[model samples]
Target: MKSVTRSLRILEAVAQHQPVTVGELTKLFGLPKSTVQRTLVTLNEAGWLRANRKDTTRWEIGARVLAVRPAALQGSSLFAAAREPMIRLRDAVNETIHLSVPDALQCMVVVDRVDCTHAVRTFHAIGDTSPLHATATGRAVLAHLPQADVEELLERGLERFNEDTPTDAEQLRAELRKVRADGYSVNRNQYRPDVCAVAAAILDEAGTPLATVAVSMPDSRYDATRLPELGRLVAETAQEIAGRRDGA
Candidate 1:
């Protein structure tokens, strides 16, 4: 367990000072150079750290490490506000409910839920980050961001999460325009195949989108007949939450 603690300490040091070298890590942790090198190698093998492909002397946290921070946001007030609403939505629709907030450059899930009666459900965890152009929750929040911020994010580029995910900036911008006009967003198999999601922006007193609320289910369960109802409920719930915040 001592060795494990040392490994975790190394990880925390790297996370705190990114793009660090083995020599710098050794100095920071007061460990021998050989010990730092061995720990870095082990971490690299475990997908927690990776040598900079361009400059082999430096290292950076890997995708696996990036994947863990979103989970840690679950205890935040943003998560607290969305939890009960998500649970209620899940029970009402007998589907999955997801709550997400805009992190620096991505949409991070704060809450994930599934109704007990639903035999088939998408099991997204609390820490997942979905593409801004793919998930309905992302689109809903993105639609409300400032145009300059939107342009900056689009310039950073969009990755296709699934075949249906939109990678074209112009197309996504146009779609976001429509979402702004309609006050909600809907996505089908954009992030995960066979799943459909509808989302609306949860606004604060100043009308800023503080978070997003989304309901997701298998395409079979959220067919054309049921989608409109689900979308309406999602939007209403978001508006209701916004109303409560304004009143308070």
Candidate 2:
């Protein structure tokens, strides 16, 4: 039990200061170097932490650690409550459906998804993260975040994934404002030139955005003429999820 407690503490410390070094962990935990090293090795073996591949001197949260989600976050059990509605929306549109939440990495991570059976469809795997400025799924969540958090994320600078990605902070700021006004978000070949998507935010009881529900399809099948209709469809589905979450 003591070892489990220590492991959790070390895990939290590593998460707090990611890409941390062995010497730093030793100093932070007030443990002898050898003891810290042994603990780290044990945790690494159990898939809780890993030495950074780019810089082995530093450590990072492992893949398994990221994959293990608790039942709820921020007092919201959104994933379980969102499943049926997501599947319904996917069937209605016959497109890939993704439920994403803004994560610690300043991006949106897919928490759940309903796959599209069409030969040509957009597929985003669970646990995959997308840039806030490049995907509708992300921007839908970002548009509702606190002002300070938005400013801080823009200050960090956007990474250009493709030609359509908004690298300028002001440009993304303007786009996010549009998202708020439109009550939904649309990504037209921004994340991938061949893909397009629409998204709407899911708010909790207090109207705080917790996650986003999205639909994505290939650009070849995208209909700009029906874009507004698609957006409305997504928005209504998201609202349904929001209603269920709030009632819960």
User: Model 2, 112-151: lDDT tens per residue?
Assistant: 7889889878888777767787899888877888888778
Worst 10 residues of 2 by lDDT: 66-75
| Per-residue lDDT of model 1, residues 20-77, tens digit only | 8998988888998999999999999986888864577988776556556555655655
Off by over 4 Å in 1: 1-76, 243-248
Q: What is the lDDT of candidate 2?
A: 0.82
Cα lDDT of all candidates, in order? 0.77, 0.82
Clash pairs (backbone) in predicted model 1: none
